[model samples]
Target: MEKDLKEYITPPIMLIVVLLAISLMFIFPVLNMIILGAILAYGIRPIAFRIQSKLKFSSISILLAMIIVLIPLILLVAYISFIISGFLVGFFSSNPNLDMDSVISQLSTYIPQNPFLDKNSIVPTIQSAGKSVLTYLVGKLGSFANITLDLFILICSVYYFVKDGDNCYNFIKSFVPKEYNDFFERTVESVEDVLKSIFYGHFLTSVIIGIFGAIGYSLLGYPYGIFLGVITGILQLIPIFGPWPIYWALAIMDAIGGNYPRVIVVLLFGFFLSLIDMYIRPAISSHHADIHPLILLIGFLSGPLVYGIVGFIVGPLILGITYAILDSFRKELQESK
Candidate 1:
C-alpha cells in the first residue's frame, strides 16, 4: 500500500512542479533569447554534425555551426543597415542650396490629377513623412544598445544549445516513462521536421523573391533597387503582405514619371513573384513534412500578433508540435485496438 501510494503521488507532483516551472520561465525576457538559440541550434544541426565528423571535437563543432549560421545573418543585416543609413543621410540633409519648391513644381505637372488629388499635396506629404521617420529613428537609437546586449545573450545561449543540445535531450528523455519513450521520440522528430520545413522553405522563397525584386528594380532603373529588394524579400516571409506595396509604389512612381508602359511591366513582375510564393513555397515545405500550408499561413499571420518577431517561429512550432502529439496518440490508440 505504501509503495503504490508513493508511485501515484510522485508522478503527479513532479508533473505539477515542471508545469509550474515552465510557467515561471515564460514570465522572463530571457525565454525569447533561449528560444532563439534553440532555433539556431536546430537549424544548424546538419552543419554541426558535419563539423563534428571532421574535427571530432564537440565544442569546436558547435562553434563552427554558430559561425556558419550567424555570420551570414550578421553580414546581411549590416549590409542592409549600411544601405538604409546612406539613404537616410541623403533624405534628411538640410541643404540650403537645394530648392524643394522648384523640384516639386517641375514634377507636379507630370502627376495626373484625380477627384481627391491636389497636384502639390503628395510630394510634400512624402517629404514630411520622411522627416518624421528620420526623427523616430533618431529617438530609437538608444534602444539599439539594449538590442546589442540581447544579441550577446542570444549568441551565448546558441553556443551552449548547439554543444550541449544532445545531452539536454537525453536528460529530458530520461524523464519519460519507459513504456512511452519510443512514442515520445517519434513525436519529437516529427516536430523537428515541421520546424526545418518552415525555416528552409520560407528562407529559400524569400531569397528567391529578393533576387527577383533586385533584378526587376534594376532593369526599371529604380534608385536603391537592392535596398528595396532586400526589404521586399524580408516582407515576403510575412503572409499578410508580400511585396505588393513595393511593386505597386514603384509602378505608381513610374506612372508619375510619365512611363505608363514601364508601370505595366513592374506590375507583371510583381505578380510573378507573388505566384512563386503562393505555389512554390508549399511544394518545398511539404516535400518531407506532412504539415498543411494553411497551418503555416495561420502561423505567419498570428505569430507576430502574439510574440512580436519571435512569434513568427514559436507560434508555428507550438501548433505543429501539438498536432504531432495528438497524431501520436491516435496512432497508439489504433495499435492498442
Candidate 2:
C-alpha cells in the first residue's frame, strides 16, 4: 500500500520535494560563499596556474593574483570616499545662502506671465530637504567603522575562496551521481562561462567608462569631474537608464554652474559612452558563453531583488543551470516516451 501511494504521488510534487531538499542542503550560509568562491576561483584559475608555472609555487602566486584583483577595487572605493567627503565639506563650509531674490528676479524676467512667482516658501522647503539629505549622508558615513569591518570580512572570504577553490570544485562535483557526471561537468562549465563573462565584462566596461568620463570632465574643467565620472561609470552597470541619468546629472550641474559649453561637451561625450555598452559588453561576453541577452537582462534586473548585490552574479547562474537541467530532463522524458 505504501509503495502504491508513493507511486501515485505526482511528478510535480516529487520535483518540489527534490528542489526543497537540494535548497536545504546546498543554499545555506557557507554554500553560497563556497559557490561564489568557486566561480571566482574558476575565472582566476588560469592566471593563477600561469603564475604558479612561472614562479614554481602555488601559494605565492595565488597571493599575488589576489592582490592584483583586489587592490584596484580597494583603491577605487577609497578614492571615491575621499572625493565625496571633500565635496561635502566644501559645500557645507561655504554655507552660501540661496539668493531667493535674485532667483525670483530672474524667474520673473524669464516667465513674465507665469503666476508662480512666490519663491519664499518653495526655496525654504528645497533648502530644508537638501540639508536633511546631507545630514543623512553624514550619519551614514559616521558608521564607517562597521562598514570597514564588513568590507574586511568580504575580502577575507574572497581571498580564502581563491586560495582553496579547486578542492571546493572537486567536493561539489563528487556529489553528482555517476550516471549524470557528464551533465554535471557541463553545468559547471556553463557556470564558469557565465561568471567570467558577467563579472569580468562588467568590471572592464565600468573602468573604461570611468576613465573616459574623468578625462572628458577634466578637459571641460568641471569641478569634481573625476568623482562624478566614477559615479557615472558605476551607475552605467544598471540594466537600463543607467547612462542617461548620469549624463543628465552632469548637464544639470553644468547648467547650475553657468557653464553651457561644458554642458554641451559632457552631453556629447556621455552620449558616446552610453552607446558603447551594446558593442563592448557583447564582444567580451560572447567570447565566454552564448547566454541569451534577454535572459541576462532579466537576471541583472531580478538579481538584486532576490539576493542583494550578490544576486547580480547568483541570479544569472541559477537561471543558466535551470535552463540546462530543464533541457536535459526534456530530452530524457522524450527518449522514455
Candidate 3:
C-alpha cells in the first residue's frame, strides 16, 4: 500500500494535481458557460459539417453554423427583454395609481370569503411581490462584465468544441482501460442521445407551443399576445409546468370580466397546446432514451440555483448524461456477471 501510494502520488503527479486544482479554481467561475458551449456545439456540429461539405472551409463553416444557431437565440432573448420592458413601462405609466379595489371586487366572487383572508391586501401584496421580482432581475443585469465574459467564453468554447470536439473525445478515451473501451463508447453514445432527446423534445416543443400560443392569443384579441405566448413557451420548458398557467390566468381574468365566450375559447386553445406537447415531445424523443420527467424537473429547478440562467440548459443535460453513464455502468456490470 505504501509503495502504491508513493508510486501513484509521486512528485510529478503531486505537482500536476496542485496545478490542476488551481486551474479548476479559475475555470469554476465560467464552468457553466463552458458546459453550455459544449451543449450548443453538439447542436451546431451537424450544421457545421453540412456547411463544411459545401464550403470546404472548416473555420468559416463553424462560424456560419454558430451564426445560424445563435442569432435566433439572441434575437429571442432580446425580443423577450424588449417586450417585458415595454410591458413594465406601459403598466407603470397607465396605472400610476392602480385600483386595487376594483381588481379585488372582480376577484371576490371566485375566492371564498374567509373571515381570516384579507381581500383588500391581496392585490397590494401581489404588486409588492412583483416589484421585488423585478428588482431582483434588474439587479442581475448589473453584472454586465460577468455576463459579457460568460458570453465570450461561451462563443469561444463552442467554436473550439465544434472544431476539435473529436480530439477532446479521443484524448479522454485514451485514459480508459482497453477492457472498458466498449463501455466508454456506449456511455458516450448514450450521453449524446440524452442531449438530443432533451433539446429536441423539450426545447423545440416549447418553441412550437409558444408560436402556436402567440398566433392563437393574437387572433383571440388578447393584449400582448406574443409576449403571453413567449412566456407560455418558456413555462413549457419546465417540468410540472406547461402552458396552463398563461391560459388559466387569462381565462380567469376574462371570466371575472364577464367575457365568458372568450374565456371558453382561450381554455380550449390552451388544451390544444397541452395536447400537442404530449404528441410532439414523444415524437421528437422517440428515437432516444425515455428520460424520466422527474430527472428533468429536478435539473430545471436546481440548475438555476447552481449555475444561474444557463443552468436551465446545462443542469438537465449534465444530469441526463450522468444518468446515462450510471445506467451504462450498470449494464456493463450485469453483462460481466
**Top-lDDT structure, candidate number:** 3
lDDT of 2 by residue, 1-337 (tens): 9898888687988998899999877546444454555556656667777898899888888778777766877898999989889877887678678575567555544443435635445555556777899998899799898567655555566666667776777897887789877767766666667666767677677778877877777777777778877887887676665567877887997899898987888788888888887778777877876667677668778977876676777677777666656665666567668
Model 1 earns a TM-score of 0.79
Our tally of clashes for model 3 stands at 0
Model 1, CA-based lDDT: 0.81
TM-score of decoy 3 = 0.87
* TM-score of every candidate relative to the true structure: 0.79, 0.70, 0.87
Clashes found in each candidate (C-alpha, N, C closer than 3 A): 0, 0, 0
Model 2 scores a C-alpha lDDT of: 0.72
The prediction achieving the highest TM-score against the true structure is 3
Best-to-worst ranking by TM-score: 3, 1, 2
Candidate 2 matches the true fold with a TM-score of 0.70
* Full-model lDDT for every candidate: 0.81, 0.72, 0.91
Cα lDDT of model 3 by residue, 145-189, tens digit: 878988999999999999999999999999899998999999999
Error of 3 at 90 (Å): 3.7
Error of 2 at 122 (Å): 9.8
Native-to-model Cα distance after best TM-score fit, residue 287 in candidate 1, in Å: 1.5
